[model samples]
Target: MHDPATHHKPRIAISACLTGHSVRYNGGHKASDLCRTQLEEHFEWTPVCPEVAIGLGVPRDPIRLVGNPDHPEVVGTRNPGMDLTGPLRTYGEQMANELDDICGYIFMQKSPSCGLERVKVYQDNGHPAFHSGRGAYAQAFCERRPDLPVEEEGRLHDPVLRENFISRVYAYADWQRVLAEGLNRGALVNFHSRYKYLLMANNPQAYRTLGRMLGTLSKDDDPLVVGPQYFSELMQALRRCASRGTHSNVLQHLSGYFKDALTPSDKSELQELIGQYQQGVVPLVVPLTLLKHHLRNHPDPYLQQQAYLQPHPESLGLRNAV
Candidate 1:
């Protein structure tokens, strides 16, 4: 009975340049139409430019990661002595605490200050190294909140990664809401119940392992201890993009709920659609929509509450791509 129209949009942190702010080293924005326009309808954004926040001027000299890839230093390309490594790391730590309320972050790709991965590191001779390193600011920020969902703008163009990221964002937002309401054994069980099929689709082994952890809890157990472990495992499981085979497995399992209600033709049609989806003839939304329609007619309370049925806002059309 939940209406997404009334649901609060999850708050997100994004690179300021992606929001059309001219905060890049060249003094121009790397504006993302997908984030600034399409996704804006579903998420509240907190634009952050770590470079600018660290007191770098617009149109400033570009910086590069140098020396060891594992512990590279952020220094100006034109002047090696102009190191901003400490400042960027400091700002990242500060923002990680400041933006605690945000459920997710979208970083600018290939940015020396914001790229999530595969950023170039330079040698003493100014040649790019064989191995790449993450942005100093991004490395520090993620270290502070490893469980928080994050993706780069470039990676978002991949439909599967995009869907997975959005799904994780909403799931994290749900966990945030649960924390706000205060945690207990019953609340934890209920949260896990809703994500049952979702977790299974993403990681079958993790789903069983997490369920057993909760199943073993007693009334005397502390939510403070159990909650963090459960949430951490849950987020990690969701990080994996569910394969078509896994999704089809979940769909088959879901169909079992209506076995007694569906007519022979209805069952046949549903099975056909699922097969097509599994074989990649159609997107996941096709089978998912049909299942939803049948559920509407049959009305099973347990099945109705599953988050897998509607992971993110349907308006986002995320399932259509996957």
Candidate 2:
């Protein structure tokens, strides 16, 4: 069980409909299974339905954007007149300000009021003019805080995006914890140490880069000159390490997780699977499946102790899944 009081919690903003609440444009919900898993395991959610929050009642007629996007108005189809621009924009600003600690956001799909991208923008005569517009609240939210990681539920279907989301969310969450607790040199060293293996599995280039970076933080290291830009520089480098890079690194690293214990037959099978992946005949998951199955027999206490490999998702694929 996760003890919220003892552990550092990430305050995440999620669309209310994704939590199985009926806050959709048509008074329905589109809860996601993976999202629910994350909700239960991690995250302290601050649910918001912008349209509902801005005084648009549940079961109300749906609204769509019309005219110039720079000055679009929300008009209800049934009424032909429900201007919610002022209230919606105002509420968005309020939420953005009040929810200062929200490290990330998960939005619903393709909604004019909540979708993060590609929403329909209608013309003055209610004809569809364009299919590239963002939600009112989402635009406002991003405008207010451009640094935060934001993802729409539809996009999370991609494995690479999902991996990136998970990694970035955890990184942001951990950084906030470090900020709150005030990391000392000793703690920072240990923190970096704990992530060493995980970094290797996720992204070796980044892992090696981080190791090299840490070497500069010695006792004689001058943070006064670099302190202002240290963390930003570190993360920016990490951001360059692609999902493909990490997935490839992870496959190679997991090979070490079972290097010593596999039987001759198992070794041959693993070898064959890897050969297939290398030859572009098989997906990376083939070898990973064998590893996960092999893990059942030769359980490493230390491997299980690590949080990164725990609860491994079979659903995710590397470049193929992406």
Candidate 3:
């Protein structure tokens, strides 16, 4: 495994077409400017065109999913006899193993072989049966690495989803570093501590649940046994995007650390900003920027270690929207 924590740029696997490669069936690209420019600056990209990798040439016949949505078959749209489901599935599995080190993946939306969700599966009569199918290769790849962060390029346009996806990718990279350094009870505990506020904002129940789970660990207990379980739960918790209410709660908690350092007037200002954030009067960045400034002056050791303060690069400006 390529240990992403040791690498300067966290590795990301992306759909080739999204990167402006002429890999689509029509010999054109879906090119996402965000992926091609913005994200490309911070992360290393590994483009994969499963269709092309499966020996399907550019400008090849378009394919569609058919039969049971849960186990759809990828077949040519014009001629159903041309099936590529088996090859695509095999290739996905192979790549999953090869790209085990990648911190995340960005799939092309609505693709019969890359769409992450809601792909249309047609009936035998050429009518759309349901829109619940997953792309053949995507389904296989996701099953192989359910813990990995993944999002369709289209979904990244939504600020909240984009922020969540990027945060999870960085967190996943951090976890990979822990694994590379060797997992132990101490390392696991420290990792959870660093993400305390982050987990609370996203899923408060998970924060408590995971805390108790770790608190129960004895020196005799094995991290190898608990590491996978803990990570699975943590990732699942992150999938639920934090609401404004949750964010307000977390902001208030962070504000408490500055209670003594802040005078009555400064405290009142901070509270008003948090209240405004809850009421949707301002974006999260406004209050967060203030909180960070206070932390810089007051400088609490624990507060400084919290990943919530800087979940992703400030240059991304993800918090400005939500």
- Local error of candidate 1 at residue 276 (angstroms): 0.3
Please, what are the lDDT tens digits per residue for candidate 2 over residues 47-166?
888888877777889888777766566678777577876677777678889888877888987777777877787896767775567777777777776656778988877666666665
Q: What's the ranking of the predictions by TM-score, best on top?
A: 1, 3, 2
Q: Which pairs of residues have clashing backbones in candidate 1? A: none
In model 3, the runs with Cα more than 4 Å from the true position are 1-7
Model 1, 133-206: lDDT tens per residue?
Answer: 99999999999999999999999999999999999998898889889999887889999999999999999999
lDDT of 2: 0.66
By how many angstroms RMSD does model 2 differ from the true structure? Answer: 5.7
lDDT of each: 0.92, 0.66, 0.91
lDDT score for residue 77 of model 1:
89
TM-score of each: 0.98, 0.66, 0.96
Give candidate 2's TM-score: 0.66
Better of 2 and 3 by TM-score: 3
Quickly count the clashes in candidate 1.
0
lDDT score at residue 26, model 3, on the 0-100 scale: 97
TM-score comparison, 1 vs 3, better candidate: 1
